[model samples]
Target: MSWKPLRVLTPRSILPALAVLLVLLAGAAAHANKPVPFGDRVAEPGGADASPVTAQSLDTAGLELKVGPGLEAYDPATGEHAWSYRREGATALYLAMAGEDAVVLWDDGLVTSVRPSDHEVRWHRAVPGLAEWLRGEGETGAAQRSETQRKQLAVERAAIALYTVPEASPWVAVVTPGLTMGFRDADGDLRYNDRPAGNCAYDPVRTVRTNYAVLVPRTCTGSGSNNHQAFGGITGYRLDSTNWQLATGPAVAMRALDGQRVQIEDGPVLGSRVFDTKAAAPESACGSRTEVFAAVRPQGTCAEPVANPGP
Candidate 1:
């Protein structure tokens, strides 16, 4: 696995996109603001409010995304409205490709899979919110306030990531403000509800998602009295902290590419390397990185394996 420079994902701010099917689970409160129909407020393509929509629109071919008060999808070739999905106050948090679809995660818990070509909604579903996840925490009002604070912190201090697992059919990791769960992207079926990594939280922030695994920027906070220490960056534990990397520096950038792989840019020295998380081989002999992901260039000569060509 000779580490080579390549690009697969987009910067987190833009939410990387691919020419495939898109399944997005964006959170929408039951009592959300009044609907803002598409075209009623088509953001001027490159306005401040349209930043989120711009990236998706440009990256995805044939799909025109107009996001302002609402999100609308149009057929660029025909200049026709294929479909329009809008909610008053929901933010487009994360986006990634999953096989023939793109999986998106929203601040609220609404998930919808839409084919960009024909703009057909294959499946859509909603998940629980932080307040609902912690239903047993405190009074309803207090719980809602607590969840709000966590969300604010997530925006200011941490990042939200959307990860897609193309294995066994596509499944999207729905990381809400409370828990991390997996849902089949093909349909809106719940695949697995994940446990909070030992002392760290996967919701709101503190957790990062890559195609192969979920990385937790582990901390004692959000563990709810766990009080135990945990790994810092790029956690290797299936659900618990078993192995790790980037113990000191700040969190790195990562994005999902097609073919069930992830490209991570650690720093200038490392440049960027696309890891074959699906590679069925012993880990790279040089970089003692996660055994499953085989990449990361070394300073010296080491045993390197053939990497599956990038798409």
Candidate 2:
């Protein structure tokens, strides 16, 4: 049987196919070994007071932040240390992102903004009367030393709140149990101080931030009895100005919801009502029994409270 001459494979005909296969394989291998966007990890340094209250991936800035007793930044792609700030006696309570910088609120009532790129401090401000309060020297009246101690403990245990709207010029708000302070992110200058009206003393129970406003649920106590007769209400402070208007009256609890809305549980008579933080307009929830206090997102999906978990 005369078999046909064996066909000869030419290098020119097979080279192109081989090259294409190699290129495809190379691409797949590269993709498989590529670093994930937010998969970088870092361990807390030794002697940390508590676990990080906030861990954020600053993808645009190539940094990752972990805030607790101090603030630390790392390279998001490699988990390498970028910079850190630790005060001798201060503990960080809350953190917020202001444009490209990180705003940290210390337990000692100090607010600072730092650039994560080079660890440069943009600006720092100590809240008025906070140092004295921390030292237990701000108390007045004829209460015993133990009662002053109790008040000091309450002040130390008070919740801290931070708000920042990312923009070309961000707006930052720092809320404490005694005062609510706002700052312009561009210059870090004090913009507004929403102090208690008249003789009423402000005790911030909770705070939530929206794109346009900061909603604070405060217990305003009258001047008598060492300002112990307190009532609850919700106030919305505009981020752009010093104007703040009351949102709800006699609320026992307040919560932040989606769509820039806040849920206010009135003092039994009005039940719970949800309202827009920007416009102070109420949203009807009918008779639904959804627990508003349990639904409040104090950190707005970014940061979590370092202190009390429930209202």
Candidate 3:
């Protein structure tokens, strides 16, 4: 009976509690429906542009794409274009997501960093030797060059590719047939320029970014051997220290996997095994025996092959 004279809940006190509950419920629902980060989204194959070369998703913002003439960012939810950049004669050779920025490698050897949010060109840098190579090609008439010369030039051009290392501070690594260079993400300043060691010709096929390293899988052909007989292996570079080393496991071409792992064919009968890069050096028994014809990233784990193999 002494219990407070049947205390009634005051509207003021109850109102605040109700408001907080409603707010939390709204927040939880909003969070549940929130768009995932663009980088987390698996890029689709098409976009609004004709012959859309590539379409990359930006999660909540939209999808960025390399259309026929330029690069574009579109709102996937609304199917509305957000931003685009185009030039008279520019072709995007490669498009990669670098954190919040987009790193585009042009056919002319120009590398541009664009902020997808506002379509701002953060910085642009020209790859070494590309300008000179282009100029040389322009200077020579098709009739003046020998067939062998033309073929060689074509091979060299084909060897040029872009590799974005998100583990390396979102740096863009330009690997040419002759040399490799790394650039800073913030300013596009040169970070390191060095040719791969050894007399073997290194044709970089793909780059894999681990949690702490950047791995480049290259076909290495000895100086005198035909490039067709190249062997595949990866050169691992420590992102923090910038030190380069060869992977300790088998030379059989391996494909990068999520969670700092790689999948390589164990042997003809053994099928394949997935190796974690973060683990200690691979066992010596994992030595190279079978040739991995392709050094591309597998779609998933060892179960699937590369859906879109790199050049």
Candidate 4:
């Protein structure tokens, strides 16, 4: 499947556990989420002399720039380290280009936007992960956890999703259950902390992040109709600016067209779907609300229907 892991089906008994999980997140999330308070609290890299270059590139072939330990930038042609950024226990997870800057996501849930000119971390924030929420609570304490338990936590952690609006544009989004936040690419400011859009199910795996929007599966939680697989529709949350603005899209995304439009591709979708709770099914079925979908679009989706959002 294109999704990471945890597309699961559990007995209804798990609902109580899931409820507890959400409660735990509500408190712990607030405590663990710490972004750059004043933007400059985190020291910036000094001038060229402060760089970590072991040696200048002797080869003239012009090698590719690579990210190594601690998000270090190196020239593959000569093994020259141009610069490096590191956090004690954090490990670099992935790196993507945000215009001229490089945004790095760390395993510890920290997202940093760095300027390539020098080794300046333009802005950064720790987006809470599922692991953080469940870290050291009553039944989920670390000391008493088993290997299997840790693996399960890791799998859930992997489920935290992200979406960068407009491809390389600076605005980057991070999503975890019960919470969502957006970090601006220009100066590392985070302005969003709610659903990008819609009343879609809370299943993170069913959500797809695109360059400009996040498409989430539709559901009628307490209503009385079973979610029609294909017709459930989707609520797209676009990174319109300081926050996620609600928008609409097809049930499934087919492909991107020439400009701001995308080619619709899904089975016939009738009027809005009606979910029947009395149809009789495990609450766990909600976890698999929608089918698998590809990752975020490289070029993003249609342009935001709204204009420039404020800081």
Candidate 5:
């Protein structure tokens, strides 16, 4: 009997299939290790005071947020909750103090003022169909607007921009979804201030040094052109009383284009680069750089100069 020579599989085809299988397995393993957002992990904790008042308010003296179901409140330095209210149905969107009253707006659109010391419902109104409006079930949906009603409400509510004039002030400005501008007074009353056309973003990320009481919204629109220029300065709102407007003249602009990967040295980094194109123009150069942390593509060449110790 003649013995036939055994054949070995070629490395090319086998390696690709093995790589694909390994990639899928790696993806599955990574997915299993994903973390949940902080908000989802905890239940909304309700407050002790459950009063029913017509109109009330509280005085906030240096406080942080304490959340609960359809309710949120500010925990003052004295450990007493200043503002407490029930928003939506078991989902509290926001909690603010208007005088001694706790102003609450839930996901469902029910706005109510509750006595903080004694959880009393002072005044309550279902903004026509706010709950349905929020859930996207009503005819108006998310973008529904009642221009006359909005204007009237603004005047009646005494809404002010949420930000304070000085960085030292304890005042906070809040804007209702209906575009109502209001300020919470030192006594914590939700009084209508003035209305501005532009929208403002919350500084929850703490990216800016300004204590986010309220800020004038700054927007930069860029067509997807390679000609990206940096704004020369940082422009902020020049607050006049309860109102806020952008400071005139240009401000130092940071490049905000997406897909921007920047190189950082070993030490602290003050600014960032949005993309390789934007990286080309630097008003200030980074100090003598250290090594970068990146993996090269398999069988790919390094596009930029790399660090090499001289002999």
Candidate 6:
């Protein structure tokens, strides 16, 4: 809900998407009802010509700093623009170092990598949704969200986090409203595999180590928002040594609640895990052979366990 200029720091080994993280408070629907503000990305007034950003660190390594609109570099020290990229609708988010190349990005998706010296395109890809879409019900909703999602997307706003570990793979955390949390490798491959549920937030518990655990929140189906409905258990996924290299696990039965406690029965789970095949089986046998994880309730009991495909 606050807007501050992104500061350029000396490249550190690890960086969280400091300027790119978003938090959703409880009781807040996942939609554009009470929209959170995406802060502006400009320097404070009267301090525009105060300092020059030279370099900064990202999830991978230290990247040189140059300011510009697209796949180009701007010299704050010299006030000169170098390098250029041609894209239909390019949203300049932040610049990071990808190996030895300067990577230009607007959000979780990569735009192109350029050389700092000449702004030459090393690698490039088309990233969709440079503009964040927040569709409201009608006129009123449109006006409320228009001031937030629209204006931010106009500037190509991005929510990014960077991190690194010793002897571990480098990773970048990205949060796009109404999208899933995405973790990208230095090579640009999505290390953290998650399908957008149209809504998501970055949680380090599952992402930092690639647990591949599928989180299944018990669904509560109720008529109102005050009923006491709960779920049988939680589900998750793990990497399998065989098969699709991923296996499902038994459900960790936990108490589930409706968002309003009244809509429990009608409130289905907003989280899920995808499976290659949709077949009914014992909860314990789920982790045996599957690329994805799912939940299976027992015959006599309402509670279920997370499933695995192949072990």
Clash count list over all predictions: 14, 0, 2, 9, 53, 40
Q: For each candidate in the order shown, give its overall lDDT on alpha carbons.
A: 0.48, 0.62, 0.57, 0.49, 0.38, 0.34
> What digit string (tens of lDDT, one per residue) describes model 6 on residues 1-311?
99999886754622444333343433345664553222112322222231212223232222225433344333454534332443434345556553455555543344455555544454444334323331222335566665557535433344232222211233333333323332333455544443322222222122221222223222222322254333232222222221122222222222212111110121244323322211212232333353145354222343356677777
For model 6, the local distance difference test gives 0.34
Q: Candidate 2 or 6, higher TM-score?
A: 2
| Residue 208, model 4, lDDT | 59
lDDT score of model 1?
0.48
- Which consecutive 10 residues in model 1 have the weakest lDDT in total? 18-27
Which scores greater on TM-score, model 4 or model 5? 4
Which structure is stronger by TM-score: 2 or 3? 2
Ranking the candidates on lDDT from highest down gives 2, 3, 4, 1, 5, 6
Q: What does candidate 4 score in Cα RMSD to the true structure? A: 24.5
**CA displacement after TM-score superposition, residue 29 of candidate 5 (Å):** 63
Quote model 1's TM-score: 0.47
- Order the candidates by TM-score, highest first: 2, 3, 4, 1, 6, 5
TM-score of 4: 0.49
Q: Estimated TM-score per prediction?
A: 0.47, 0.58, 0.55, 0.49, 0.31, 0.35
lDDT of 4 by residue, 171-246 (tens): 7766665566667787777666664224343445556554555544443333233643322444445445222222
* Best-matching candidate per lDDT: 2
Clashing residue pairs, backbone N/CA/C < 3 A, model 3: 38-58, 38-59
How well does candidate 3 score on lDDT at residue 219?
50
Query: Against the true structure, what is every candidate's RMSD?
Result: 22.4, 19.8, 18.3, 24.5, 30.3, 23.4
The Cα error of candidate 1 at residue 122, in Å, is 2.9
Per-residue accuracy of model 5 over 157-193 as CA lDDT, tens digit each: 3222222322333334433333333333344444544
